[model samples]
Target: MTASRFLDVIVGVVRQHLPAGVSTRDLDGFMDRNRGLMESHIQRQLGGLLARLPGPGSASAEDPELPELWTAAKRTAANLAAMVVAAKLGAERRNPTAQERATLRGYSGWGGLSIEGAASKFPEGFPVPEARGLIHEYYTPSKVAAEIARAVRDLLPTLTGEEGVIHALEPSAGIGRMLSAFSGLGFEDLIWHAAEWSELSGRMLRALYPKLDLYQGPFERWIRERGPNWTGRLHLIVSNPPYGARGAAVAEDPDREYREKRAYAYFLRRALDLLAPSGLGVFLIPSGFLTARTGEMLTLREKVLRRHHLAAAFRLPSVKPGGREALFPGAMLVTDLLFFRARGGELPEVDTADRGILEGSYYREFPRHILGRELGQDAGDDDQTKKPRWGYQVEGEFSRLPRLVERPICAECRITPLLKELDPKLARNLRMGVMRTSLDLDGDALAPISPAPPRSGSAWTATWRSCRPARPRSPPSSGASCTRRCAPG
Candidate 1:
C-alpha cells in the first residue's frame, strides 16, 4: 500500500479501538498504559506487510518497474511506522514525552533518509531536502534564554492556576533550548509545543524533546493550519523569533493599516493572537519595536498597548567590553526582553521612576492607561523632528513601582531642546547651537568641544554648541552639562 493508504489504515485502527465517553485526561492515561501493547500491535502489522513484500521485486527480475515497486515498499514501511506513532499520540491529544519518543524512533532510522553508503538501496531521483532559512537559524544566547525563562516563570502564576495542564509554545524553537529551559523549571504537568521553520533545527529539537508537539516548516503555514483551535488555549508563548525579514503573506490589518510585514512583527502578532485572555507572552525582540516610526512598527506597538497589559521591559546591553556586541555577536542589535500579558483582570502595579538608570541598564513598566501617551498627537507636536529612539519610564525607582510615563527623555536626545523646554532660556541656548562636546572614549570627563562626526556607537555628540564655550557652570537640572552658547552653525 501507498504511504497515504498506510496512514489511513493506522488512523482507522486507532479510531476503531478508541473507547467512547473517555475524557481527555482518561485518554492520556490509557495511551500511556497501553504504549507497549500498541507498539507490539503496530510491529506485528508492519511485519506482516514486510513478509508480503520482502525486498520488493527480487534481484532476478529483469523488469525496470520492479525497482520502482521496491522503492515504494521501502517508503511505505517507514511512513507507516511513523503514521502509527502519530495516530496513537493524536488519540491522547498529547505528544510523546522523551522516553515515549525514543520508543517511537526505534521504528525508523535516518528519519526517512537513506543511511550513509546506503544510497544505492533507494530510487536515484529521490528529492534532496530543502535548505533551511538563515533568518530562522539565528542562535539565541544561553544567558538570554535563561533570563527569559525566569521571567516567564515569574509571570506564569499571574496568568494561570497552579493545577492541571498548561500549554506553552515556542514559535521559533531552534534546537529546543528554550523548551529545555521550561522543562527544567519543574512546572507541574506543563505541555511544551514548538514550531520551527528549519528542517535541521526542527530535527534537533525533535531529537532533544521527543514528546514535543513539534511542527516542522514555516511558522506561518503551521499557524494557519493549527491556529483556529489555538485561540485562547495557550497559557504562555516565548520565542526569539526571526528578525528583519518578511514571511508568508499575512492578511492586512484593515484597522491598523500596517505597511511593514517583517517576520518578527508577524511572529509577535501571531503569538498574541494565540494567547489566552489570561496568558503571558515573553519575547526577545529588537529594541526598535518601542521607537521605530514605520507604519508597521507603530501599528504593532499600538496593537500591543491596546490589547495587552505591558508588564515589564528589560533593556539588555547591545554592546560589550572589548568592543564586541552582546545579542548578535558580530552584528550590533540592541535587544529587549519584553514580558506582557493579555488583558484580563486588574494588573499588578510596579515601582518605577522617571528616566531611571539602574546600574547602566534600563527597566520600565507600561501600565495600560498611559500606554499611548507617547504616541499621542500632542506629545510630538512641538518638535516635528522625528526622534529615532523612545522608551517608557516607571513612576518610581527600585523601591515602589507605581504609574508609568509613556515617553521618557532618551539618552541621545538629552541635550536637545526637548528636555530643556521647561527652561526657555536654557532650551533657547541649546537650540541656538551652543558648546560642542565630543566623546572621550578613555575618560568620563567632558573633553574639549569641536565640530566633527560623533564616534560610531558612542552617545556623545560631536557638536554640542556651534559656538565657543561661555564658561563652566553647575549644569542645569535638565542633565545637559558644560553649559555654553554659540551661533547656529
Candidate 2:
C-alpha cells in the first residue's frame, strides 16, 4: 500500500475504536486494540525503504533512498498518529500540553525510526525531525560535530588566559550535542551556559547537563534582557544557530531594528555583541551571509568585518541535485562554518584558505574508527586534489568588501584602463572634475552619470529628471570585472 494510504488506515482505526470524549492521556485501550494494525504497516514501509538504500560509500547512481523520502515516510506516520491523538484530546475541548505536542510530533522517540543502528538505551534521543518550513533545525551529524570539534581545537591557543574557568554559551543548545563535543575535547573547568527555545528539548538538555545555566526562551529576548550584564565577559560562543526567516514568536521590533529578517543573522549579531575582549565565536550557519546580494546583507557584512576579526570560514559541501542525501535534509540553504573573534584592536589577520581539516587532501583523513563510526565506512586514502573541499577565502581588512554606494562606472573606478575608446573629451570629463557634484533626489545624494557616448546609439536616452545607462560590459581578459554601479541623479 502507498505510505499515505497506510497512514489513512492507521488513522481510521484510531478514529473508529476511539471511545467518545476519550482524552489522549488514556489512549492505552485504543493503542492496545490497534497496535498490530499500526506497527505492521509503519514498520513494513520504513523497513522496505531502509533496505533498498545503498551504503554511504557507494558512488553508483543506482536507486538511492533520498533523505527527504525517508523523512517523509517517518513524518507521515508520526504526524498521522499525532493528528488522531490531537483529535482525541480536542474532543474534550482540551489543548495538548507542550510535552504532549513534542511526543505527538515524534520529538520524544527513537531518533526518527533508526534503521542504521539498533535503538540505544535512551529511545528519545537527539534525532532532529525533518525541518519545519524554513526553520532548518536538523540535528548536527556526528561527522559535522567532529569537524567543529577540530576547529575548536585550532581555536584553543587563542583561549589562553589567567582565568581559572572559561565561560562558553551554546545558544539553541539542541540536546547538548555541542556541549558533548566540548566535553569530549577535554576543556577543563569550563563554565557552560545553554539557551533553548523548545521546552521539551530544554528540559532534556538541562537534565543531561545539570551544571549548565540553561535559559529557556527565544534567543533574541534572552540576549536583549541578559546582554547588558554579559557585555565583554563571555569567553566563547559556539552553536549551529537555527536558519530561517523571523519566527512567529519573535516580536517585529527586533527585526525592524536590525533591518534583517533572518534568524541566524540576529543570532550572529547577538553573539558578537556578547563577547569578551578576546572572545571567540564559531557558527555553522547558512552560506547566504557570504553570498547575499542585498543592501541589508552588504551592510551587515560591513558591520561584522569592521567589528570582528574573522579567523577562518570553511565552505562545506551542500546537497547537490539528484545526489545522495546529505547529513542535513530539508535544509535547502547551503552551509558554512564561521570562526571569528569579537571586535578588538585592528582587525586581526585572517587564515581563510582551502587547507583546513575539512578542505583539500586533508579532509577525509580522519581516524579510521571515526570514519567507520560517523560515515559508516573504512577510511580511504584516495587523492582528493581534484575533489571539492570546504575552505574560506579569508577577507583582509579592506578585501572583498563591495562598495555599498553605486558609483558611476566612468567615474572613480579602477576599470578605466580597460575600456579602450577614442573620445578623449568624454573620458577626461568622466575622470574626476565634471562628475564631482552630487544632485539630491528625494533627500538622497546621487551622482550624475558621466555624459559618455552610448554603445547602442548616438545621444544617451534621457528622462525628465534622470537617465539610465546601458548594461556595462566586462572584458574576459580582465578577470570578469562587471560593473554593479549605476550613476543615480
lDDT of each: 0.45, 0.46
Query: Can you write out model 1's per-residue Cα lDDT over 1-489, one digit (the tens) per residue?
Result: 222223323432343345688543465466557756765666566756633431211111112232112343463354334434544554556667755553333322232233434444333233222323321233555445544553354334444533456778888886555665564323544687789876545654554455679988777666668764565567788888877556444542332333345667777866765665547777877656754445554545655554454556654544444333233433334555666665421111121332222211233333342221232121111111122234222121111112212232112211221211113343344334334433332222232222342222111222333412343231222223321122000
Residue 348 of model 2: what lDDT? 18
* Highest lDDT scorer: 2
Question: Candidate 2's residue-wise lDDT over 23-52, tens digit each?
Answer: 543564565577567767776757577445
Instruction: Specify the poorest-scoring 10-residue window by lDDT in model 2.
Output: 398-407
Report the alpha-carbon TM-score of model 2 versus the true structure.
0.46
Model 2, residue pairs in steric clash: none
Task: Please give each candidate's TM-score.
Answer: 0.45, 0.46
- Superposed model 2: Cα runs more than 4 Å off: 1-135, 160-162, 252-259, 320-322, 330-332, 345-489
